[model samples]
Target chain A: MNNELLAVRSVSKAFGGVQANQEISLTIPSGKIIGLIGPNGSGKTTLFNSIVGYHPVDQGSVRFQGKEITKMLVPQIARLGLLRTFQQTRIFSGLSCIGNMQISAPVVRSGLKSLFTKFPIDDMEDIEDILAFVGLHSKRHLLAGQLSFGQQKLLEFAMALIAEPKLLLLDEPTAGINPTLINGLIDRLRVANQELGITLFIIEHNMRVIMNIADHIYCLAHGQLLAEGPPDKIQNNQTVIDAYLGAN
Target chain B: MRAWHYLIILLLAVSAPFILPDYRTQLAFLWLMVILALSWDIMGGQMGYNSFGNIIFFGIGMYVCAVFQRDSGLEYFQGLLLGMGLGGLAAVIIALIIGNALLGMRGHYFAIGTLGLSVVAGELAGGWDYIGAGSGLTPPLYPGEISERNVFFYFLFFVWAGITFVSLWWVYRGRFGLAINAIRDNEDKAEAMGIYTTRYKVSAWTLSALFLGVIGGGVGNLIGFIDPKDVAFSGATFGVWMILMAILGGKGSLWGPVIGAIIFHVTQELFWTLFLGWQRVALGLLIVLIVVFFPEGILGWLRQRYPHRMRDANNSTEKNKLNK
Candidate 1:
């Protein structure tokens, strides 16, 4: 319990009559990369949403950092140092890359009074560093809408990084990204997990990327947990192979 | 666009009444339009919560101030000042109460919800006899000369508009601006990024209401009458004009609504009498032209045409400051 960073117990969510996630339970221990993979419509995104308080769980509770966050709102859960990126990139398209980073920066340390205070110009170097880290340094001044879709995904990742969250939930970080940038993103994810000591919970359809980075993997099918184990074991597990890896 | 340009505009505004003493009331109304457009942009443009019922606060302020003045029996200026303060407070309180419910709505739903709010306020005020019902309430007459009254009201509006402009400028350079702009860009992601979207939305609306409410009191006193429908809560006119003027200038940028208001008011006032019976037609044509040619507003048009010019202006200012 003390080592666990997040614990979701018997969580269930329904969209009217559709049971997206049913009796799902999972634990992410500190400083580990956890992967959640499933075929399309297997409730992968719904579970991420449930854990981060995007919507209320129909039954069960979520605990982050030893505190129950099931009843909290998105921003409240976010303020506790757990943040998530969208499956479709969610960068502020009208703002410059730096502007997106600046907006995400203040949320980590301040309260309502910060609203009237000046932009934290003090974070300029930090923002530049993170943008450079994500290879978005050259596009920092351009409106995010002008960026290629891959760059927009990187901008969204950089935004989550700027918040310096304790645990980052990434939904398909490489979904629309350029193939060449995928390896670079994987390296950065490892650095964030190992060097910066940020835990990661990623939902990926890209088996190669997840297998390369995730320490442990969970397989979900038909809204229920199918398998959980080390990457290699999960890769060879007959159930996961038949259900998700497609027996090829 | 620069500090000197602003200074020149300030000089012109300050000297306008003195130079064109005949048009003092029209000039006062121009400043009122500026206040309306600027306040509306805080929600409609910056925060992306396009509210149509902001005029409710304005009416509340007008009635609150007038009622306080009537019942308090205080000195004229003292009563007016206290009344305006109470009116502003009343608007903020109302915003706080309804903000949670109404602001929870998104996009067109929020717009429609707010539209219903002003109509209801109009009906409620129209039927309330305590505030004079439909016959209207006449505020105490200005104590000074007829011309002096114009100048006094002109300066009152001028001062308030200036405060609105400066306060928005200061706040927009800060976290509040970034937060609201994030909401404008994408609200769901803004919440995930840890912005309290509802709190910021309510605060932004309340801020707009505070300005509108205070100005509403001054407007009531300026016009010297408060018709529950036409004057105080005229949704079809003042409320719609607030949105139209902001969109005319540009919705998102800081100076868009300001410039938009200047053009809108000048055009409306200049052409209102000239067109006579065709004034509404002329106004309709103007709206059509704005939507067709300048959907992004005048500033948006200019920015698109001379994007680098604005960027250069900003760069040069920074370069000059660094040199100094």
Candidate 2:
């Protein structure tokens, strides 16, 4: 039994003549934090989209726990315990912090019963717990739109965590966030991975954040995997340094 | 709180026909408007998808009942049931096609698609002669004298009450409401959180259409006359009015649009009777004023004034708190 939770095998995607992803293959283990870093237009978000079923792979296979899910819709893939966040925080602006979490909470499909009944299952406690974990318990009633950008990012994390996903794909979790909040978010991510044992595949431009938390790293440039190794090894790799640091 | 609220509404509904004047049969008309507004709110307000073609369901309801009575001599209630079935069937098809296409199109395009559908439906109705073409079929009057109009009025009241209660029950307590609200707030996020947004949107359309259809049939039977102009114009006006009420009452709050429909219809009736030809202009101006100053609507204003009382965390919580 392979302990791999997700495997993207030789996946290729092209838009018109532009190849967005080129034969990218990666395996995410059940309890690991893997960092994905790349220069702009390196297909980091594209790969994330493909894994979460936002974008269809032109030629490849995506397996989740040994089942091929390449053709699954985004919601179907999400229901199967693989979830992804957007590059921009996708918190429900109209919903409260807790309401956002509740929307993502897993409930059995009860058709009309789900539509017409407000059953108070143990979900309320689950919402409160997730809020506390994300340090948003105090702001549970606040509209998500009213939260600061950093707070919204935290809310987004809490929303994802409420689903108790087996594999979490986080796109630029630290991007546009202040350094102070970034550290707190990183801590939460660490806790989510370590304590909850949720596998995290993150895309981040912040090398410091990535190197600090990632158990392993994959670097991409121009839709191709440039390097893959432990953080120290990736830090010294010529391709990663040249592709990422050269531009900066 | 919810139980008490419904109890009060039920008491009022049960006593309305006795306390209110007979000439105010128009009040039943207003109740019909409330049902229509609530139906629109479920799809547009709660689901966050603006549908201009909602009138099609209303028109289908009206025509189905009208044609059934004219061709088969079906009783008013039987015609109403047929209309509802037709509306649901039409809605399931339209929702599957339009809902799927519109779900992927954001904002303006979605609105335009519905607008196009409404136009096409109206044109089709106008061209069909067996269904009365430009002229509409009329139902047989209540099988009694003019003095018995109040009896029919009471019947309409119960029908309206039943619909309003059912809609409120489903929308406030059901999983459908949760799914629809989730889709409304952030569709992409909802999808990524395991919501089938397209399916829910289509289901909302189907449900809303079913209600609108039955109400349309009831309204047709109430008037005992149907014409293309009445069906098309009234349907279109009600569609617009539904949006206004949803905005005025605050969308996503189940009772908001109902209150809006009542207030708006009552005010319009008073104004139209008193001001005559100037009534429409006055109503138009009022809509503008309401949108400009109190964009959240009356319920929204009330909620704002008393935030703690209406803290559902889904909608109006922020607006209500801000108003205070």
Candidate 3:
């Protein structure tokens, strides 16, 4: 089996005079933990954005589940079970943590009729379960804004969980979190992958976390793909070291 | 706050004309203000659209209804009923047509775009001689005593406003409310979360237009004349008042606009009586006070002050749910 869930072919995007991603190509196989690493402004985030339909690409195409999706809008792509999380974490701060989850319920996006219907009561159990999984159950009723930064990130993850996406693109999931929380987050990400059978494509700056968590890794420098291999090979790749990891 | 509380308020509202016959007109005006604020809140507060041209629907409604009564030659009551329904339908069509274009703009762009739309609507109505142009249109007279006319229109507004409130309450309790609130909090994220943001935004605007248009017909009849700018499309008065009232009470909460409308209408009426020619200045000062001290509005301020009281009520309900 090809096992490819997402395929990006020579995708190029430029913002005015700046080339954010140039002829970038990659694949996310089904049920795999894929990691993207790059120096600042190296177009790691841009690639994620392009794949998730945040912006139209200047060149190239993105295919999800063997279907062309380069021209699809964000909501349409998301409805196809491709969802993403932001680097800064975008929870509905005005709503309670539970409310955020409730709003993110799959039914909300299911169809026109679902909009007028009350949120299904049975979803509450699932929400509470995921909240507890993220250790946010106790604070479910509190405004999401009141949560700590790490908690907010967890809430965002919980929201994505509620959507029941097939492939989730996480942008810098652990940048602002402390080490302990990072460890916890990594564990949940693992559980979400292995237990839930969801595929993950993550952008990470944390060397240790990405190395340990991702089965395969892609490294970018200056909007160009620098290296791609299993984690240990990417770790040993001289080009990646020279461009991003620095000489030690 | 409770079933009984709503019941008491409804009882008072239903009995207001009889109890205060002298202030019947003023009471009717209160309901008008309520409808305006509530409708505006759906887009401005909930969906974060902040459209300034909602008055376009009201204007269209007034004109369509009056024109129908004039040209259709139907009896007064039949014409009025049919006219109001046609008015609402016309407003909805206009909303759908314009919303697709205007709703594409975000933030200040959307607001300015809608404002321009409002101005353009007024100008169009002013130039169109079919519905009286700058001269204004007059609907057929009410077929009853003046007192009966007041009571009839009063009930018309009361029932309409009640329907508005109840409908909003229903909408806000469901997934639609959550979806719009998500859009308000963050549009990009909302889209990425699979919310067709444009669809929701247009739908929200359409809901406001639907209500505003229907009410506009009744208001045109109540006022007896519809000047293009001053009456039918009074952007300066009705449009601005709706936004201000929503802000004054609270934007996001269900009761905020209602509370804000009641307080603002009563206060504005008082200012008209007390300040006379200076009422505009008094109103301006009131707006400043609301923004300065209660930027979050009265409900937000109350929530900030007694967070636990609200949370406790929530907790009790949640605990009962858990027990069940």
Candidate 4:
């Protein structure tokens, strides 16, 4: 219990008759990579959505950095240094990739002065370095819509990095990317955790990626927590394997 | 694209009344259209709110200014300034109140809610007797019928149009512009990235109200008389025209609405003069055509044809040239 960065205590959510998540509890320690995996309808996405305040939970609490955040909106959570990315990659299609990078930085103070001034030079430099790190420096000038789907995911990831979230909740970062790019992306995620010190709570579908990357893994099934342990233990856990087998 | 290109346009705009004195009134109206379209774009185009009720601000501005002039025993110019100032202030206050309520409704709900606001406002203004009811009220009569009044109003409108364009242009290049564009693209994502969207939307609408209210006061005095349905709350005319001009010019670009206003005004004038009674039909047809055929507008087409124009200059020019 080395100072949990995020604490989800007995959280539950329901959509009419559908119980999307029930009595789900988890803790993510600071400076660690955590994985959440479940079959398509097992409430994995719902859990991620709840933590980021895309919507309210029917019951329970979410505390980030020991501060209560259950009542917060998405932007408020982001301002508090918690951020999440969409599975579909919600980059602004009409803006150039650099524009995407530029807009992603949290505004310190948006005032009448914001109307008259250019974005700070420091932000520009930061965006360039982030873009380069994400392997998008050459394509930064291209409109985000023009980028390939894989590249757009990278762009979205880079944007989240620029926001400088203390804890990041990524929804399926390798959903549709080619296998060849998977290793590179996983390498980048580690670098983000190790170098940037971002606590990553990733919802991953790819077995190889999650098993190799996550320090601790949580298995969700039928809207409840099935198992939680080290990645190797989760990988070897008979119950976790049987749940995936039954779902398949 | 270049400073000189804009400078030349500015010079031409300033000299338009002198160059064509006969069309001074029409030019003044055109400048007003530029203001309306550009200000409307602050919400409709930039933030993707598509506020059909924006004309309410214009109408409020007109009534407030006219009421001030009629009731207050101040000098003409002094009264005009005070009336306009108060009018803008009133519009901003109303916007803040209604904006918080109205902004919660997304997409078509927001659009329809705003549309109802303008309609209800017109009806309310029509029934109220203190503001002269349906028959309308005239501005304080000018002494001795000043000869250069058209030129005076023309230059005034030009100056206002210049202010609207320059002010918005500054915003469109900065952080606020990016915030609105992000809202337009995907509001949820913008908020998730840490932009407080409701505050931004309300603020943008308030800014639009301030400008519209001032323009309303100016236009009210320029016209000298106002009818609740026909002039002040002419939602069908002014409201529709604001959205149409922004769309025709290219919705999200800085210079798009201005160019659209010029083209739309010139063509609309020609249609009004040529077709007379059939101008409304022509307007309907032109809107249909623009919506169907040129939905992207001239700027969008230009952006597509010349991609380099839309990219930030931070990208090396050498790379740009190579891509070209």
Candidate 5:
């Protein structure tokens, strides 16, 4: 708890008659990989959304860097160095990769005066460097929509990282990525965590991928935390196995 | 290269008064339409909000200036300046209040909400006797000859159009433009990236309102008359025209709406002059044809065909530089 960069406590959220998340609690220690795995409707995405302030939680609170952010909106939460990506890969498809990167830094909140200001050249070059890091350097001017789905995911990752987020929440980053590119995405994620020192809290369904990367794993079942432990322990845990196989 | 292009347009705009003196008044109206279309594009084109309520600011500008000038005991130009100032302020204040509630609605909901606001404004203006109700108030009578009045208003509208164009051009080249395009492409992502979407949306609308309000005041002085529906709150005409012109020009690109406004105004003018009684019908058919065939707009079509150099080709030049 003391080393935690993000703390989610007793957070419960329900949509209409269904309870998507029922009093879920988790902590992501700074600069470590934390995995959230659940069945399709087990509320992995919901938890990510709630934590990022995409939606307000019905109960409980969220703390980032020891400050309460439960009532903050996505932009406010994101400004405090907490960021998240979507399951559907929400890059601005129409903008060039650099444009996407440039806009992702949240420089428009200063009111009307911002309209008159040009982006700093340093930010532009920094975006280029990040694009290169993500292996989209050659496609810097390419529209995100024109890139392959896997490439779009990479661009989305770069967009998220462009802000130098202290912590990143990723929802199904490898969902539609091809097997060949999965290794590449995983490597990028690890590098983003270890080299960049960004705390990663990810929701994934691919067991092999999660097991290979996440230091700690969480398994949610029926809107509750079924099990959480080190990847190897969680992999062999009987309750975790049951939660995955029986959730259908 | 871009400077030369702008230079040619600048020369043409500056010389139009002398070169086509007979058409100065009409040219002024054309510039006014350019301001309307280009400003509308800031929201409807770049941001994809498709607001139909933009005319609300225009009507307010018209009435506020008209009322101030009519009621003010000040000198002619003084009253005019004072009215324009107050009218623009009123528009900014109104936009600030309404932008939050209305801009929250996405896509068609935003469209309908703005449309409702425009119509409600028209209805409210009609009911409010202070601003002349259904009859519409008039600006202070022009002290100069009709031609002199037209020239003065022409310069005013022309200068306003120039300011709107240059400012929007600068805006489109910067981070604000990218943020706007991001909102158009995916607003949720824009927000999640830390760009406060509401602030951007409201600011864009406020900028649009500021121009519309000022130009509305100019329009009141240009015509020297205002009727609630026909002149001031003519949503069925001016309101729809702004959206159609932007769409016809291609919504997202900066020059699309500008080019769209020029061509649309010319066509509409020709119809009014040549076809007379059949103008609206002809305009309707033309719009249908544009919507059906070139929905991406004239600029969009050109961009597709050329794929090379277009000033407003989004990132064509930037893409080229990156490739190099």
Candidate 6:
């Protein structure tokens, strides 16, 4: 019953006879690590997309910090301190790693002045800090495309972190990373939540990552929530086993 | 280079016509190309919108100037301003209509949509007599022809400098530049980060059009006569030339288009004087070779070879060197 940082109430979305998400209700309280787990096509991504305004929900409402943001644009939601990352790591390939981070920082001015003057005060230090946090400070000057797959994943993480969002939605952070990198990413997420007090709603399929990092877990099967509990109970639940683990 | 570097370059440019020979007129044309290329770079290159209809604004400016001069007997400078205003208005309207429809399309489709719009604009101009069907119109000569030429050349040089500097500055320092670059890099990621991709894209189109309009007016006044074929066909060539210059110079680099324009136009003039009809084939070959071998263009190639030399030192000390 702690104040919910993000409230998704009875949200539903559909596309041409296919219901991607239906009647999904979830609340993420401030400073908690919540996991969203599901098989492929279980509407985990669709739901995340809806919350972040990537895809409009056909029904229900999304309220962040007591503001009804259903009609807001994606950037507006992000400015309100809610941010999401793609499942496939997306970084500016042409830009250096630091350049990618710098461009994502918000702009303060419009017109001629904004073009001529470089406001150095805002997020330069934060970019360095995030790069160091993600172990990418050493590679800060490298073109993002030059990074290895694991490093690209880290860069994406760093980019998301630079925004300093109140709510961070990570989509499959460990999808293609090696086991060592997975541990590193999970450790960073822990630090982000515990040390920085950033709320996290992560969509992950890796059971080890979910079990190790998630405070609470929601499991979906074929676009419906099959189980929800703390990691321990969710791991032991028969419905989760039959729907997810049994098939695997 | 720092801001001082730009100031020095502008000063040198302003002083050039005084010392340079009759070739200043040719240099003025080169400056025009640079302005057009830089304007095109804003929307097509930096924003990755891939528009091929850039000539639409230029043509609109030409036609409007023609109409204003012929029908209203407006002064040459006044006609240019009127033309620019009309062109900008047309660009805003067309950009909203076409940009909204085609901005969502990726790659070739987007290019084709812009090309289609250019063609439609060309056809519309060809059918309108107010500007001139296909025959075109001529502006009465302003008195003091020699002094006027020098004045006009210098005027264009300053305008060129102003437009190029402003365009580059806008792309480099502002939120709009950041947003445009984000969209170019990854649209979905940019949106998720709270950048409005559509609005930024359309705005880029509008800004680019404004510059194109101004340049078009300048060119129309410089020539003293305008025709639909000149407006449409030459305008289209201007669009293509802008893209070529942008790609050749370094699409994302602020100084790239300027350098590209100078090199491209100078070479073009050289070829036209020497090879005449074969210049087109040679130019085509050059473009193909550049696109194939040096995808990032000359500045890109230079950056690869001398990475540290191109680094913007004041922006970030931890500048990552781009590998060839």
- Choose the strongest candidate by lDDT: 3
By summed lDDT, the worst window of 10 consecutive residues in model 6 chain B runs over: B315-324
- The list of candidate 1 runs beyond 4 A from truth reads A106-109, A245-248, B312-324
TM-score: model 4 vs. ground truth: 0.95
Which candidate number maximizes DockQ? 3
Cα lDDT of model 5 by residue, B1-324, tens digit: 366987998898888888988998899999998999998999998998888889989989989988898888889899888898789999999999999888888999888787777778888888999988887787888898887887888888889999898888777778778888899999999889888888889989998999899889889988878888888888999999999999999888777888899999999999999999999999999999999989899988887888766544665545544443
Which candidate model has the greater TM-score, 2 or 6?
2
What candidate 3 gets wrong by more than 4 Å, as runs, is A245-248, B310-324
lDDT of 4 by residue, A1-248 (tens): 97899999999999999999999999999999999998889999999899999999999999999999998998889889999999888999877887787788865335445544567667777888999998999998787999999999999999999999999999999999999999999999999999999999999989999999999999999899999999989988988888988744
lDDT of 1 by residue, A120-210 (tens): 4568888889999999998887888999999999899999988989999999999988888899999999999999899999999999999
Clashes of each: 0, 12, 0, 0, 0, 2
lDDT, each prediction: 0.89, 0.78, 0.90, 0.88, 0.87, 0.77
Stretches of candidate 2 off by over 4 Å are A16-18, A108-113, B1-11, B73-104, B232-235, B305-324
Winner on lDDT between 4 and 6 is 4
Candidate 3 lDDT by residue in tens digits, B1-324: 677988999899889899999888889989999999999999999888888989989999999999999999899999998999999999999999998988899999999888877788889999988889899999999999988888898899999999999998888767788789888888988998999989888889899999999999999999999999998889999989999999998897778899899999999999999999999999999999999999988877887889878654332433344444
Docking quality (DockQ) for each candidate? 0.74, 0.63, 0.83, 0.67, 0.79, 0.49
Model 4 chain B: weakest 10-residue lDDT segment is B313-322
Give the higher-lDDT candidate: 3 or 4: 3
* Residue range with the least summed lDDT across 10 consecutive positions in model 2 chain A: A108-117
TM-score of candidate 4's chain B against its reference?
0.93
Candidate 5 C-alpha error for residue A175, in Å:
1.7
What RMSD, rounded to one decimal, does every model reach? 2.0, 3.7, 1.9, 2.8, 2.0, 3.8
Model 5 off-target regions past 4 Å? A106-115, B316-324
